[model samples]
Target: MHIEIFITTNYYIGCFFIYFFMLYYCYYFYNMNRKSKRILVYGIVLLCVFGMVVVYKKNSTLPLVILNAVRFYFAGNPTEDVGYAPVSSKDFTVSVLASGLTAPTRIALTPDGEYMIVTQLTGEVFVFSRKNGVWNNKSRLAGKIDTSVLGFPPEELGLVGAVFSSDYADTGNIFFLYTYKNSEGEIENRVSVVSLKERFGTLVFSADPEVIFTANVPGNFSHQITDGIGVSIEGKSHLLFLIGEGFDAKRAQDLTLEGGKVMVIQADGSNPLGVRPYPSFPKLQAVGIRNAYTLAQNQYDARKRVLIGDTGPDIHDRIIYAPFF
Candidate 1:
């Protein structure tokens, strides 16, 4: 019904404009003629009504009719090609290194594409390096990682998302967002920046990661969620962090604990250099989200928005438009 209305509206508007132009032309051809003027005006009005009827008929959909048409259309057709040429499945065998890992939630690729990082549901960030056109695991960023201050409940936790510095090919800086313990020994969601060390030209994971910004947000492990990490292209200090509510729906509105917010901050884990801080607490971008899973900037538009695939109770999966900074 909606499609029919839409198509009808567009078709009528188009036909009306065309009819009006023809009426004006007839007026030009027969100026001050009463019959010609009546014909012109009546003809155009009749065309409009007829157009609506025709468009309604053309756009209307009947389930049974459509099903029969589809069945007949494909009944004797042997050609697989309809519009696009088909490609044989055996023609390509592209394989990724971390396909066997369970619940590889997020992936990060270096600026040079030489290395890739995969975060897992088990709280481990697995590093994959491209060597001789093939990828291999280099290291796993896990173990000895504090969870209490980083904001996760005393349940099983693992790495969620990671990002290499836009200048990592030159600066070797990388950051990871996960659940960890705070200063008071409480689990929380937070982001941390760590400098990757190049030992003999190989990247190695570090345990003594630099605490850039440990969010003081309070929440249980199941309530805190940070899904994706990406450095802002505008400034090295500016970083985009995706905040969300975990599978547990009861804690979506907890703002003090960074439950559903996009926290943006510096590389050293501080607010913008000269900007006055918010009264609520640390620096943050737009808040109020369900579960933001992906953060990306449009290459052509330079607009930034988080791709939130929220877990809902029998609701449609939505892709929300989170405005750019």
Candidate 2:
């Protein structure tokens, strides 16, 4: 549907440009002097020659040549295409680990590296493992979360992120972030934890999930439910979360709200870490963020520096870094 709309719109735009230019040429041809007319005739002849070359060869060189000529006229230099060099066959190889997935968003592996958990954007989780020297897909629904109830498109409101616990091998705990519609018919984002277990020789999750956090957001704003989730690495007791501003930039600076901030809390959702000079919201790590699309903790840095990719408002994108104490 989107592709059809795009092609139709561009087709109309191309028609408009062609007709408008034709009318302009007809009007100017009668009013221009002899020298101007000669120049216009030469330009039209050159364009016809270029079009014939493009139509006959069906190659990209004509467009590139035209673009290079324009660059030379404006910047006094034309771009050169350096040919590719030959390389040995052993330089690269490809392997397929898994297949037949529906819009897979995130993949989390068990601490022991024996099992892999894959999450789908359509609200499903699959577990993959190796058996008898071959990887097998043994996926099952993790819970009974109804994605249809979200009352919005899957791109806007659906399962967005997932992560495994650091002690997943022993505890079998997993976390997820998704969007849902509340009782008031308002869209909301939620983060929850659930335990995975083997029942009747098949891996499955508990029927219920322990809800950790949720935020009410406007239903029409799709960017409200951005990707960010808590991850435990190297037996770290603290879990890190990056929340977006929900299209409300002012809420980012407000300490009362969780939007547009880095939050750190214990694994059990207790004992929120306090930011210096602001102990009121212990979970608040940093604020004044517009839209943190990506978050990472530096493994090599001794200070446990947290890096954030913030989507700015009409100006520029920014990468922010701060200590994750």
Expressed as tens digits, the lDDT of each residue in 10-67 for candidate 2 is 5556556555656768998989999988887776666555454433354223344455
Residue 96's lDDT within candidate 1 is: 37
Residue 203, candidate 2: C-alpha displacement in angstroms? 4.1
Q: Which regions of candidate 2 are displaced past 4 Å? A: 1-92, 131-134, 137-140, 147-154, 198-203, 216-220, 225-236, 271-277
Every model's TM-score: 0.58, 0.62
By TM-score, the best candidate is 2
Candidate 2: the clashing residue pairs are none
* Residue 265 shift from truth in candidate 2, angstroms: 3.2
